[model samples]
Target: MPQPNDHRLFAVILGTNEIASAIALQLVRAGYCVVLSHDPDPPVIRRKMAFHDALFTDTAQLEDIVAERVDDGVQVYQALRRPPQVMVTWLGLLDLLPVRHIDLLIDARLQKRRVTPDLRRLARLTIGLGPGFSSDFNCDVAVETRPGKIGFVTDARWTDAADGVASSLGDVGAERFVYSQFAGRWHTPIEIGTRVYRDLVLGHLSGVPLLAPRDGILRGIVRDGSEVPAGVKLLEVDPRGRDAQWTGTDQRGRAIANAATAAVRLHAARRSTHRNPA
Candidate 1:
């Protein structure tokens, strides 16, 4: 176990979606102290594949990495000592992390098609993934998340837009995703990995019943009692049944994560060269 405060590179990821969780896992494995900033109730699919549930369950594991949610600054410090296991905080990681010590900042929230604010000066290196991110404007670096180009890191001024559809799985397309029909508290008894059939009452939004679109495993869903806004993704069905993958770091996620780690490595190497030219 690598010591927390002992020269290991530290990274802060904004968001706890599966993408963020994947990046955190690879970074930890590659010898970086990683911390995630986000709340517990994410409208995230693939619950077992991410740390968004850590805030709810207090701990979530992705592959060999475990993410524990820390309540305050003191707990964050203590959690760090448990090497390779990430610690998430509801409070801002930037606020809790030492002033100006963050080596890398990654925005993995993947706010598709939304024009987010510029991420300059947040860390020594800032990387934004997926659409609406471009190097030199929104972040120091931009990584491609479009299909066929998941890990193409670049310094380009613009990136392609998301097609407004998630990649298909087990021959299932966007129809497998369930979204909130209105802004309200979401309620559901079905847990992750539960088997369900079409028309099953998976949950409700402010009393509006939500039903399954097809027969399959409940791959991911919002926590049973989360307050969710209209149009946000609420749940997903894998449709693969016996072949369903309800856990572990996924393939595309790993590609995106590898890109993040690669960008950091290149940035650190460039900085080192500039400081000590040979």
Candidate 2:
């Protein structure tokens, strides 16, 4: 547990997806007072492996790391004092900064858009994950998440950019995911890791049917009651069978998370050099 007045470096992570959750977990272990922000109803696909459920469940855990949802800055401080529990909040990025100064800020949303420079001064060290970010352009540092698995920290230039196509397994590309066709509230009674068949109605969007594209294990789905727009991701199927583990951390997520931790250390090293150079 961390105390409000303690000297721990504070970190604000701007997403609750699995990748963001991984970064929070690693930073917390690295002794950062970490906070996560999320939408009212985040359309996250991987619930089993993400802290996104904490926003609804009040508490969610991944690989022994527990995340507890807090409503406001007051509750956030309270949650921090509880040892080993990470704080998750509905407070947006703008509202959070005024609550406390942040040492680092990470955008793990993977939105794949050219980010505005508005967030550059938000923290002492700001990091953007994935292809849409560039060092000195949008964030202070950009971490590479190209071709889906690799993660590297970049400086002085943009990391790998997207080519409008996602890397996939031999045949998994394009066929494994389901995207929304129309705009409406997403509803689903199904849980992640559930077994299903091809063409099964897994859920609905504003009363319109959401069918399973192909038979396989359900790897991810948008949260029930999420108001989504057209072109939004609805769900994903693993097609890898029921025995495949769909929970806990993913290999790619861990890589990206490790890189985020490295970025923090990199910034610290540079600061040390400037203040006490040989």
The segments of candidate 2 whose C-alpha lies over 4 angstroms from its true place after superposition are 1-6, 40-42, 79-84, 169-171
Error of 1 at 22 (Å): 0.7
- Model 2 is weakest, by summed lDDT over 10 consecutive residues, at 76-85
Model 2's lDDT to the true fold? 0.80
Query: Per-residue alpha-carbon lDDT of model 2 for 1-278, expressed as tens digits?
Result: 34554455778888888899988889888777788888533367888888888888999999978888888887765544555347788899878877667788998877765454546888899999887777868898888887644787776787777665755643576677789888899899998888888999999999999789888888899988889977757898887663455799888889999888887898899999999999
Q: What is the TM-score of each candidate against the true structure?
A: 0.91, 0.91
Give candidate 1's error at residue 31 in angstroms.
1.9
What is the C-alpha lDDT profile of model 1 across 1-278, one tens digit per residue?
64655455767898888899999988888777778888333467677888888887888888777778877776655545655568776778557656336778898877775677887776778899888888968899999988778899766677678777678888788899887777898888998999999999999888889999999998898888888867788999998878898788788898999988888888879989999999
Q: Which ranges in model 1 have alpha carbons more than 4 Å from their true place?
A: 1-6, 39-42, 78-84, 97-100
Candidate 2 lands at a TM-score of: 0.91
The alpha-carbon RMSD values of the candidates against the true structure, listed in the order shown, are 2.3, 2.3
For each candidate in the order shown, give its overall lDDT on alpha carbons.
Answer: 0.81, 0.80
Please name the candidate that would achieve the greatest lDDT relative to the true structure.
Answer: 1
